[model samples]
Target: MKKCRSLCMLFFVSFSLWNCEPDHKKYNLETSALLALTSTTSVPPGSSFKLPDANQTICYDTSGVTRACIGTGEDGEFTNTPAPFLLQIQDSGETILEESSELTWQRCPFGMVWTGSTCIGSSLNVYWQVANAYCNSLTTAGRNWRLPTAREASLLADHSQNTFLPNTYFPNGQGAGGWTSTPAVGFFGRYLVSSGGNVTPIDETTNFPFRCVSGPKAPNASFTDIGDGTIEEANTGLLIKKCAYGQADDSSCTGSASPLNWQQALDYCNNLNFASRTDWRLPSIRESYFISEPSIGNSNLPISIFPNSSQAAISWTGTTYNSTLSTAHAQMVYQMYVYSKTDSANVRARCVAGP
Candidate 1:
């Protein structure tokens, strides 16, 4: 009985030892799962794996902490101050021409020659063709010069101050008349007029004084078709009506343009509503001149863009001469002239807006 009891105790001790042994398969699976979790997860605060945003540059601190450098200033610098860029042009002692228009004037007219600083107007007047050829052959400041266009010449006159070719820039006592590159519709080869800002047409064969201009030729006025029956002049930023008043078609004023008296024209323009705008009004003489395409000759207006433009000899302008309350100015663009007329006289109206 003692031996059997001892054997039973030994058997129970062996069973307990077997149960305490580790399972190698389960241990390997748990170890692999822990390694995967560590590999997929983000690195800790001081780890090298961390990165900055795509637009940012990485910056390092003295203490070995990584940081992002952002914004306009130099990387890692707090202040965002920027430096300004400037353009400077060298100046010569000669008169500085207008940069925007790139135009410079000779000190004297054609007949009177420019003798450096001043001019002598006693020279004989030359024919219009000779005047043009002389200007074309002129070489000033290494630039090929040419005769001034009608519009360019007109710009020299300050109508507001009633001044023609201010004496400060142009030599005084020189001939006040010059030939323009613009040609008249009915009369001669090219137009000639007095220097007093008047557009009196003179025959091309007649001798006249002329001024030389040096710069880029005046470009054809650009137009933007708004597709809403309105055209915008890119040069002057003026929006023009696609059709003239009393014209039946926008493509062409196949019918005669309706003529309204000065007051009626003003009222008609003020009441006009087209292209989703209602602030239309009669164009000023300057604005009217802006749309005039003297280079195109026909009607002295841009017929391709302004299809409904009237072929009429004269059109009413918003400008009024204070000399007489009853008279207002009209632009005879075909003839390249402006004249005062009775307010009651019927004239065509073309609406315009913006400066």
Candidate 2:
């Protein structure tokens, strides 16, 4: 009996020393299991978690005898404290991302021209029917269409930089009202005029200016080469065609193209399906000319189609003036004017795509 007691006492002392060792990495986990369970685990402050959650946030000191963090709604319940409290080291090493908001947007690459610090572009002013039809025609690069957001429209200001002007000069005092995706404050997302400078709420029937946007104009994309290629994945149903017949000039054919008429043109490009595409339509004047080459007289079309195309004769565009040419009164209608092969000639129609 005395020998057994001495052996038992010796075993206890040896076991205690083994567990008290500082270097735990060298210790076998199976053998260390015999040690205190609480000693190996850490708890942090400002960390919250549930049992199913394995992401342990070390935001607290998980040392010594701490409160028992267990049970459903007891002290162990995951609260506002971080488990294993410690300052979180950033893994991505980034705290901010490039903002997509209009305020942060400095330039527009697709159809917009720089005015001051803001980007400005032309838009069609028409009733709801014409407005929707017009928006359906805009195509940037290969993208068929996109209406500007309220914020995007409001971002355009006379004091801002990068805006479109009537003249080639960017800073020229030329601006147009644009389309807005934002609904009025008191109304739905409708009846508003966006000028990239101000958002004026109006009735849907009121004629207003509008602008077009390229599909998420990426950094790698070029403004001058807005429509230069085709898409590999055509989920939008319309393919991006870099043709010149629909553009103002050879220099401006970098946008999408759809062979269509004014009425069917919108449907053809925006809705697609020249044969089967669901998104197809005609491009707006600005969008159609994002890649427009300047011409003098009615000279947008190919010389073969309109033989009169010359330096003096500018080409005709699909977009028409709202008011008819008359010395007596003004009329409201979408009309296009440009050089024609004949004095009073109507040419074969073309189309473009939009988002």
Candidate 3:
């Protein structure tokens, strides 16, 4: 009977210990899982769980690998974190974005009138005020503006089109004969007005008109005469004057005039006695008229040639008055009436030749 009682007690103790072992192991496993779950981004399989502690973020995923770290809520809860995002930028390389919106005012060359991108008008006319006002009222790109500098003004005159105005704008138009930005000093033999930075008398207030232009700054030089290795100014261009002998006006005589009778003057010319060149000739009545000097009443010389050694004086032509005495001469002088009477002996003579 004693042996049986001892065996029963030992069996009871072994059964109790075996049952407690499983509970202890499960508790340890649960603790380990909770520690990992504190990250707020992982989950354990087949387990009902909460945040490790009130401050724990409780990152949880379906498989515990796909992570989403987020801040913990007041009750240790978490909101869904937004997905990742990206940004993009645009690029603009080396090109100017032109504003081709509408018509506006623009300045043309000094002597030109603006008609869109083209400039037109006589090279002799178009003074400053007219030009400025016209430019101010001229419309391009939706604005009115004054003409550009000599350089900027020339862009409108396209020699390739042979047009002062583009053919597209003026189909029946002649060669492009508009204002330019080039100054007269460079190739036009520098004018008096140009020296003072003023417009020519031909472009007087009552004579010339204005054109408008506006756009990019006018360049330094406008039209280039590739043919003659020259550049035409925006205002004057190559139209101002034509080249002749070294002489300008009628007074351009290479040799001193000798007081002579009609026969003597003729003989002198035939001899090529003047300027070493043999092609000397007695000018026609019309040609001689340009050399005639107006009577300034002997007051100081006119400002035209004052201070300059080149004094202008009237000269006689070789033209004959009639079949009268073989030596009768018809002298051509400036500012004289064609029907007026005049003495022949008092007339002065200047000789001219061509190169």
Better of 1 and 3 by lDDT: 1
Off by over 4 Å in 3: 1-127, 171-203, 219-355
Model 2 CA deviation exceeding 4 Å by range: 1-124, 158-173, 188-196, 217-355
Ranking by TM-score: 1, 2, 3
RMSD of each: 38.9, 32.6, 46.5
Error of 3 at 110 (Å): 13
Task: Locate the minimum summed-lDDT window of 10 residues in model 3.
Answer: 81-90
TM-score of each: 0.61, 0.25, 0.23
For model 1, the run of ten residues with the poorest summed lDDT: 79-88
lDDT per residue, candidate 3, 165-225, as tens digits?
4344433343322232222321221011121112221211222333344333311112323
Best-fitting candidate, scored by TM-score: 1
lDDT of 2 by residue, 123-198 (tens): 2244332333334453323344445443333223321122422222222244535554433323222424333233
Question: Each prediction's Cα lDDT score?
Answer: 0.51, 0.29, 0.28
If both were scored by lDDT, which would come out higher, candidate 2 or candidate 3?
2
Q: lDDT: which candidate is best? A: 1
State the lDDT at 89 in candidate 1. 24
Error of 1 at 293 (Å): 2.2
Backbone collision tally, model 2: 94
